[model samples]
Target: MPTGKLEWGRILGRLSPYTIQKGFRYLKHFGFKEFWIRLHERFEPEEIPYGPWYEEYRPDPEELEKQRKRKWKNPPKISIAVPAYQTPEKFLRQMMDSVLEQTYENWELCIVNASPKDASMEYILREYSRKDERIRWKKLEENKGIAENTNEALAMTTGDYVGLLDHDDLLAPNALYEVASALEREPDTEVIYTDEDKVRGEELEHFQPHLKPDFSPDLLRSNNYICHFFVVKKSILEKTGGFRRDYDGAQDYDFIFRCTEKAEKICHIPEILYHWRTHESSTADNPESKLYAFEAGKRAIEDNLKRSGLTGTVTQTKDYGFYRVKYPVIGTPLVSIIIPNKDAREDLEKCITSILGRSIYSNYEILIVENNSTSQEIFDYYRQLSENPKIRLLRWKKEFNYSAINNYAASKAKGEYLLFLNNDTEVITSDWIEEMLGFCQREDTGVVGAKLYYGNNTIQHAGTVIGIGGIAGHMFVDMPRERSGYMHKASIIQDLSAVTAACMMMKRQVFEAVQGFEETLSVAFNDVDLCLRVRELGYLVVYDPYVELYHYESKSRGAEDNKEKIRRFQTEIEFMRCRWEKLLKEGDPYYNKNLSLAKWNYSLRPKD
Candidate 1:
């Protein structure tokens, strides 16, 4: 079997045929420039260089020493728990040493050894315990499973906050310090987690960093994205009853889910504070060794849904650890798909035909708002479309104002839900409306966005992250449709700050609550502004990958190549900055602070 670099080559070899077909299709729709971009992305190196990021991440030795020496006023004591079972002496020492080297002194390392007969492991534990009173060791008479062992370690904790660490993993030198800092900043923070990376081979080369967003419940349900360096208030952990025996392999996932459910505030530190060891025996290196873990994770998600009073079914995807959640539709509310079009008859026809022919949902109306189309063919097409009882034609005699056209059409919409769809977009998912409706109907959700692919099957918009291009930009743009994004986020249902209005669904109530779109800002950033306002109303903006579509993005409007268009775009950018200055400065809650704001893909941000 191929391994390492050869593995990707082998995989690519198998995908070449399908890739070629997809490439040709893209060329047919998007032309040569898009095809070339997709081709380049297909073979681009997946491993992102972390050298500059590490330089930015690493703290000064003198500053760290000062932090170690300084006294904190009434600092909360944190207990670090490690469950050991036949652990190697080398790995065991490294794990214990990481805790010992912490800059924050108000911490206790609790080790519960399940391997009773391992003399070397026991000796190392005894030596560490003898050196510092903070290091506590408990040797079990018999070998218990991971969950039971972890519970034993938890039982030893007397601190206000409790943290879980894998036996083979290594914590960063300043992990506890950062956790303490965040706690100092947010006293109400009940659940705290930090970003982590995987250390592979004997040299302990760190790579595959999982830079996570700030407390995303939907993202957590999709997978255990918040895996390592997890800390929680001891009271909350006690309420959750620690770990479950049934979910031994995924006990941490289950525990974290329960903790989050009851947490007042969940905080995420963007720095890498944990190093997950990726040896052959480690699950990080070979997930096939622990197939039961994924199954347990699915069960955990299902239980969470049940507890939250949500009607949903969770299923595992082809991607090893990722999951798919199908939220049950609450009611068969009429959905009015409001599409604004000027010309582009072929694009409009294709979009309408896809919806009428492929959609499984029965109750929906198509409202195509014609904005000054002079062509007779467009008029003839409109006449034919009017023949269909499900289609409605709304006329907007004014100049092309995307926001205004949508607002006018929305006023005429009679459905409970409003679907803002681009004329250039075609449906790829049969139950797209059903999927979107599921999220929109939820009490907490305001806007529901679908995963849009470029005509060639490359991602157009997975979700929108604020601060990209100094305002807002699409996430995972130009990525292949087949891949499971940074952390399988592109393949799962997750909460985002915003999703494009190009193909978005929202309740009619939410649209009115946020006063529809801002017409003053003519073209760009209108959808982003709308979503942000909806979020300000304390509702989640969801991005569902299952509701897939092909967005031949902006085919009707064309490019902003002219001076007037460029000036108008700049004006809109300024408006957004003025309106959402604080949010832009603080960054998107659905995106990590450590991630690059300049790039659409979740690249590491360089330090100033």
Candidate 2:
């Protein structure tokens, strides 16, 4: 139960007088039910929790001392940039003090006081600057936009790297130390970001941490997940031209996208180093207050796409800042739909019927491998389905092996792309193939999986996480569909470590390149193993919620009922552990280590 920023966050603001006021605001905007549900979910305890986890994980006095004395051949100084505009005296003092208390010494605080008329602001800035020679400030003639104000601050930096800091936010004492340490490991790193949590009210109680994954391009295209504690090598900052006033509201988003586009090595420190202060007017507190920012974010993603020689239509989703990018089908390339079936006539019938009847992307073929089905009706149905020119049936006379069966069919596949679908599923989205194909068509993407729901409209598989339930399990399992489900994760497009093969789409070459699925993995974890290998080859495994489907997998099909079945399942588990030992032990890079691995929900890490 560690922290929740399921997009960048879900349960964002901590409970406080201000938070309660915001709750009433939500009640007015969303009516009573949605607000009530949100409040109720906050108390629904999960396997891991955040508050205790942070305290346990946070570096103590001894660790801080070690960091202070840590040797370096040539330590890099990080310049802290702050653009102050009528900032409250309380907030200004806390922000300055946070920098002064840094365990890492060789850093400077660069501030641009845009509020020149506010004499008290000048006095506080003068006092702090006098106290520490490292602290410096410049007063502007008049308040320029945020972008220009930041540029003034950026102009003052002489450090090797420049980090963005809001005037009212706090920084962990080890924040600079962590940045310097990561830079040591990756000396060539251009862009570095750290995980962040929200601090609210007079107490500044940290809540709803945004524990981020490793640098994900697709996830950044969705939302500014690299929002806080972001530092860029000085060269990249100069190259990206700092920031633009055109994207004033979301200047950081625009700047981040540009910096990442040019960055050779982007490093992420999973520890929560940044504290985002949430107030009524702050973007961290209220999304609607900054529609202009979200709109600017859309433009940012669009520009990034254009710069990469890729084209996509970007649109903001219902979730305030989260977006959706529709990548165009490159050239209507052929897709081969590969489905492995056994003696399940009804399931096979529905599956085949849905794809043939619903899929709008018509340039495709279906490779249905009949894997030793005992039923006569299944054979009859296969015969009927084969009548369609696009549908081809191949017989797998050998005993049931999910990997082998798919491999046999894949060998016979003619199309460029391979979509492995399960018989227990029905297509929900009309353009599901095109949706999956959009991401699959990307050169860097190796596999794409669909969002699956049970017949009851609860989520079955949004994505797959390694080290969950002792192997890998579908994330957001059985969560209600209507709810945004942790930072609108159920709706946004992002990269994942693995996805269920039930409805996975990938390039045929990628499948062949990875040597197809591991035949040794007979049934369980075969898909996960395939994805893990695909990822090993340095290709992205994407989870596209836009490609929706209903999976009728039996919920009651819990554990193997007999000893032989149980033994086979255990072997599969053992095989996954043995083969992908590093990923299992180190945890999924696409998933934050601070989050829970015990449950489907991205709960906080559990208490010891």
Candidate 3:
């Protein structure tokens, strides 16, 4: 939301030798067409300053005064717990001062000091306690550990809600006010968390603001996205039993999982209310400093999986802090790979060959639906493929109606799980089917999508986003597979609003529950509609980057070049807009509002 001229000089300065290196690599590997497209997508949007944007939307003095004076009908008191160690005088003062400056007055700060050696902190806390009665302090003779220290602070709180605050970090003036507002909006909410950013130095120069999506369970398992500005109900905290010493390095991550699982209604406030201060010794400044914390995070995810009545081996991904869970395929359930094909015998052959030859998971049947293929060679290939017991050939006499053809094939499928695939796609990962099946087998997962690339090394579809290109578009389109998306989103597995049906998997019961894809959306948006409807039925659509495939996009059906095809595409777009009017207007919950919908990349929205 920056409102000013583009600083071209500063923007060009960011194009370092690394940028040039990537450009040359792209040109050498992907050719000029792809190189130009990738370059445009990366640099077309101006890189705006988040500091100015924050300052522009930040609440003024008069607004804060109004919040301070507002009377509430039984406002729930929020108790903040701070566990302190060897805290510097400046940081300790700032942390306490940030709480004291809160607009909401019905709050208390419970400080459990383990910094016995730092005598200066004792004097600071005593002075603050004298100045404000809400500031309560307790000095522990010995540092019991972070988990126990937080528990000691939690024991001191008497409010209805409890919040955790790191001693060196800071809370924005509106942090407590937002929590109170969310409680009024959703009274049954047992857990509430806000987005946060990293700040440094005396002025607290803001950067790396995390504009998070709605509460996503699958995404949380991938990484601890909800690490800051967190608050929970007093009852929920009591039920979770605070934190455990075993997960001391990553106790907050473990505690968050426990709280969310116990809460009936969890709310997310999309505001940067916490500033995680980074200094020399802080893990935020250097990830390599505490490798043990990452291992503990992996354990926390494993424990959550066990609690959910599932088992998986959680392993670290290429990204340092991020992790991946390889859930074992339970009981070898049959998977139906349904492909709707026309002519393109070569394309269909490649698709089936990859599944039969490269696939590591057996016990899958391929149902190939032939939709009016005129070529004699395709029929010849089909006749040869019919000999295999694992492959079944079905006929569709009607014109290319994508939804109806798939629905008919799905009705005939005998498997418990259904996989919708495009004939133009060839499997790249050996265990691609198993990779997707692992996540799809989860009770909460309704749809699972694989990471797809174009014929070249560039990406075709990582996931789908609503209201991107009028209705919906794929994320990370044309980006090289070697590079990651914004904030390494391309490299991580997370929950999304929608995924391309060209390579999607879901339960057979779920497909029937939604009555299959909407027949009205014959070609375009049919997959997105099905995914959205599945989500409405309280299910998550996960995009796993580990499942890889090469998508020769539209090779069988060809492009929408003719007049009739273009008209049909336009009609589908209008249909999606009318059907999903609310989502388009309100924005996608899986995507952040601050990000630009103008492009597939998660770039900053230009505030003109």
Candidate 4:
């Protein structure tokens, strides 16, 4: 084992100690399991522990099989609401047919036809209702928009919970079965949502991950990240006052934010229970969605932020562009930049040079923790740069502990903000400092990160996707530069559950508030743990693409072999399970639920 000399600087003051203490504890509880799961997978091998708790907790195979074959004693009654307005009969009929063909026998189809003049839609819906007693169809006297139509259907729902089916979307064959089972598993779960996939022209296009808890208002502020095929408790819907008609373009997002805020518990089933249809008219298919939906989303967030008593700037763009926020800073905020490195002097130099040269804002310092360096040339280069007053050196003379080194460096930082930068990354955008600074200046922003691209000009990380099943994977991995998929919606910098730590910024108050980083993580998931803690503070975590950086990832450091990889991965599992157990049990809002190791176990490892 390697031991690094600890450099403890002036301790953080006890000012607002009450808020800080409570905030820290809240994050610890909220994030422990998520951090544990990620780190456990990263550091501990699967050979060390074969079966997961689910296997142990699950019924015997024979018993499960017997139960599966058994008839429903008390089947759940679900009201599937489809608010079809001006949608073609083919699309409307497909949606109706999917619902009518549900394996679950107890369900009702409530289609509030808002179609301008389509009597054919009514005829098709009526034909289905006549065939199945459960199918119910109604036409509004006037053309109420999506929000109003959804509210109309919601008003007619008498089931325990309601499931919203889009006019064009399709449900998986077993979607209702899964939702019913999840509801049975946790009766207290008032809100239940599952993962979904994207379909275009009747062909499956791509899969989207399911998110956990899905309640954290800050996470909702970033985007309507959660796909809403929710089986929400009718009472919770009523309590939250159902859907607001004002948010026409993005009513589901507004209603979800309001409902989750009031709901007692949220349960996320990690399965692709729904298929989101994407055509030219669909928002997911249109790049300009950010223009219309995002603008409406910004208004929704501003409304929520005001209600939550948080004041921050909101930037919007008509085209695919960078969005920002500049919260007023009352005084100087200390920011600590932690870089964990090995022996790559050139990469380190480039990272530092870009920051020193491009960063417009000052009042920050860098802590470089050289980990088990075998290259004396790198050491000499450090000496050569020693004349730069802002850089400080800390050596981890033993085995590399990525988390431990950052924790050590953070103790030495005097700034009010903490930034974790990869040594192999270089700043590409000059306002990167202000881009991040503007976010942290707000009291509500807990973590801020930049978009990272590889040297080949491909994305390294746009955002982290929780529950890729092993060691939390990132979305849009290795995707080309022309693609503006999620980032398009994420363009307007706002609240997210977590942001990548590669080039992250957070308030110093938040850093100490979370008690720095957890050292047990050693190599992986330290940043994720930090981000989760930031969310616990009831603040927003943002990924600002405007603050761009080029990351030459894993070049200096060699890849961990199979055994080492498992060690890191196992630790990640344990950390996430322990810290964010609620999220794991519920699901992470930002992570795609469509992926499962149970489905594609062999492809779990990154493709070479």
Candidate 5:
């Protein structure tokens, strides 16, 4: 691993001129918040301060031993396949040892030697095979690529499930044990994957963890987040015909996409079961070392899209591994922009003006849900705004129930799509409406949310993460706006459990299907409640970072610091718990259980 000083220097050296330019823009627009966060991030990128949950998930040897003895009703034998091509002696031994040390004894380690000339690898494989009956070894006649080599290993496996293992990687001692446990619970699970982290340098310090979500098809299209600790039913693997040679660099990704399409049930084990070794040649250490991998990844996504009958153009982003799928608007449907405001005329005007001035989408209307604004200035501004044919003012005489207000406004909306936008948010992206509409109009998508920044250009809500702050909270909150978050999640377009109502767009049919937002959640967590309810109906809630906005967060409603507001907030929290207790306790499907629930960003749960 690089030393602290050396790592800091490298980080500085990689800082692009574009980042510096964005920094200056943020300083001018948002003031000191962006500057302060940038400085703090530069110094302490990995040292994120987390709450009690950080200490709660420490690995326990006693627990592992207990799990080892636990009886399973139906524990399927797992066949782990490793395609070796001149693998290092140390790494090769470690890989073999990790499988041999599995707590679940019903597993076979299938090692296929692609490099027949590598005497050291052959000797080690033969020695290990002789020592353990479960260890299977096969020497190839000639050296094929990773795809063909792995396929050869797959043919030798007889287990119910076939697992993929890297030649230079290490699995947690209890990795196969966890896989068996999950299968015992859900026997029909066709595909299973786990979170992973990188083993850096000679010291093998664990870092750069990829705490992945459950089965997310959209997220899979963005990038192969399920790159390691991957297991699939042998039947499913056969149906997919293993990996393709054309996508050799991204063979796993292509194979996974194909398998998932035919999979009946997909399961995710939220544990760091795999440690990806980051050597100089490894993609984890330097992505640029194999640019062909990214090109293959892009092709994988594009092929998946074509197979799924979705019309989209897949292209690589500046972030090497990440991709952007641009789905064209299906039709020119009228999108109603629903703004619920009380008194902030200036904020409301700014939001409306930005939409009118910057938006390229032609078919849209603005609905101002007037919730008892007392100011004469606000009334005057409303009267002037109502002059436009596209704008209309609706009155809500009752109390400030966010759900009730939006529900009332949605009922009166004439557009095919309803966009529940906050009055305090200003549009940053010129094609923000078009970008959101494309996703919302999709048959599978439920709700679409935009990336929001604070007045200081720090992230306010990249997306909503369930179980954060004990209920749900905005993801990547307070991070510098320009930075791509963990695994480029903050910048990529993907499926999430929930998204903030601050700038949410959805089709009229979807809104009606979920019956709009829950009125019981009057103030706090109403958006989350609505999103959860929407997800319950089997539709995906997406968070698109391409649609950018500046949200002077809650500038109209003010803070929840006062006594009455705090009481109401607490009541709403209880209401959400009472309503969606299963989702909260079991974990968000769009988030991993191993991640810290206390922090908004994807921080690792610290060991005690």
Candidate 6:
């Protein structure tokens, strides 16, 4: 066994023994609040006078040297901004001491005071400022609220980047050093955020890993996963004009979205670097705060909608974050649903019926391309369906080429949008049209697809995991419903690098812009190729589980047995190598590198 795997095995070996027993005990004792807090403070340097309690323990000299060597670089100047309201005096002093003791020397501290009644806060700030020139203090006559106070502190930040720290939150000793190193590595990054743990009183309770590294707008749109203590470029912050006072309760989320829009790049530091205090009064402790958050979030979404020039109305749904959008019918954006088939006329009929019956939006035409069907029944079925005004039948006459057939259909399409629907899939949602159309209608979105599942209720296609088993393929093949795992188990809507062509929708303009699919590669991996090209053109591809469908793989066509499956798989591998060389070089935009996928292990074929 290799050393790395061997070491991992050994650790895991020991873990399994205590994990069950100790895990339950730990959960009962500390809870998520304490666990989250302790994980972050675990690595924080303890030399600071005050701050979260770091148990008295010194790291081995060799390990300390390794840690120091990892951060060898020109550190960017980082300013820690602490907006103090009515926080305890001890907590304020502790926060100051934590900053002063950071291993990364190039940092300044800005304390914006919003407490007029407490002279102790001012006294502590004055004493800290007097002790360290890097510490700066500003006092308000009255409480300006946390959001406003944060804005006030924003003006005092002169460093390359600004780090948000609540008066009560504590930073690990290497927090600044880790961020500085990450920024140094990704110089173009405008925002650098880290995973954080929550603290309750003083015990470690839970760990929330923010391991997602890719910069995805859709991910942010869905939830504020990149929140908690984050370092953002000062220039970008200044440009966005700090937090919007209008979004008082959710100002941080608003500011983050606007800042992300202006930022060209972002980096996620995988380590837990900040300790978030989780008291009963804190937002983490209260669910009622969701109302304000929702309103602010809605405002942010409205702004994005207007900016994108999409005509839609948002309405609240019973589900907390769930919403319904009614898109007004402007001039009909003609849509063509392209389907490829060989045999299985019954399956095709069902597929077509679902679209015609369930679609809330009208103004779409279906194009069924017959791929050399050797069945007389299939020929008669098309003849019977020719009377349907919205359905068009095209005969491929030659061999079955999934890519070529779609490209041929697209060339004949009169619609402004192209939808690829597989004959084997049955649409289950009434809002499928609106769900996909909303994304396809957006100028920034290129391709949109629906979630697919087997007849057994297990997932069939949520998204594709590139570089899986020396071949990039679909993930969550047949997993039972459980915790929302990586393949969008919990999310109804998400941004994916590629969706199954089994049921995909795209704007005709984007399809034409990328010249549709590469006809050389037939059925497999063509969706990934199309999506990659679309993304390269600066458009996002989204996968929405809201429009659910049952996909009986290759049911419309005769299923190739083992020998043909291998042959087709080999062909797909070669095609993927030729078309997706860039993705292989920089890595798939969606696949998490730390994950155990088969595709990440190989060097893609050399680009021509």
TM-score of every model versus the real structure: 0.92, 0.94, 0.91, 0.68, 0.91, 0.80
lDDT, candidate 5, 241-350, per-residue tens: 88889998899999999999999999999887898998657887656667899999999999998888898888887655789988899879999999999999899989
Model 3 segments beyond 4 Å from truth? 1-46
RMSD to the true structure for each prediction, in A, is: 5.9, 3.4, 5.1, 14.6, 5.1, 8.4
Clashing pairs in 1: none
Which stretches in model 4 have alpha-carbon errors above 4 Å? 1-76, 86-90, 115-127, 198-222, 276-294, 315-331, 339-348, 368-405, 437-448, 461-502, 506-544, 553-590, 596-608
Q: How many collisions per candidate?
A: 0, 8, 0, 69, 0, 16
Task: Give the runs in model 5 whose Cα sits over 4 Å from its true position.
Answer: 1-45, 48-68, 561-563, 606-608
- Candidate 3 TM-score, true structure as reference: 0.91
Expressed as tens digits, the lDDT of each residue in 1-608 for candidate 4 is 00122222312342246434544543464376543332232232322121232223223556535544657656677888778888887888788777765666667778788874787887887788888878787788888877889988887777887998898888865677777777777778888877655665544444332323344444456556565577788888888887777777778877777777677888777665677787656775543443465666666767766766667666554332233444544455556788888999899999999989988777778888988888889989899778888888888787777777777788777776788898999999886776687767766668888788889987787766555544455545565544444324323444456667788887877888888777777767777777887777777777666678998887876777789778886876787778777776654565433223232121222212
TM-score of model number 4? 0.68
Q: Pick the candidate with the highest TM-score.
A: 2
lDDT of 1 by residue, 1-608 (tens): 00013345654674656445645655775467655543454445544467445656778898789889977876999999999999989999989998999999999999999999999999999999999999999999987899999999999999999999999999998999999999998889999999999886677777778888887778888889999989999999999998999997788889999999999899999889999998656778656668899999999999998998888889987656778888888768999999998878999999999999999998999999999998999999999998999999999999999899999999999999999999999999999999999988888899999999998889999999999989999988887786556666777888999999999999999999989999988899999999999999999999998989999988678899999999999899899999999999998988888788877777777677
For lDDT, candidate 1 versus 4, the one ahead is 1
Q: Candidates' lDDT values, in order? A: 0.87, 0.87, 0.88, 0.67, 0.86, 0.71
Q: Best-fitting candidate, measured by lDDT?
A: 3
Predicted structure 3: lDDT: 0.88
lDDT of 6 by residue, 288-338 (tens): 435676677667766755655666666543323434444454566888999
Native RMSD of candidate 2 (Å): 3.4
Q: Compute the lDDT for candidate 1.
A: 0.87
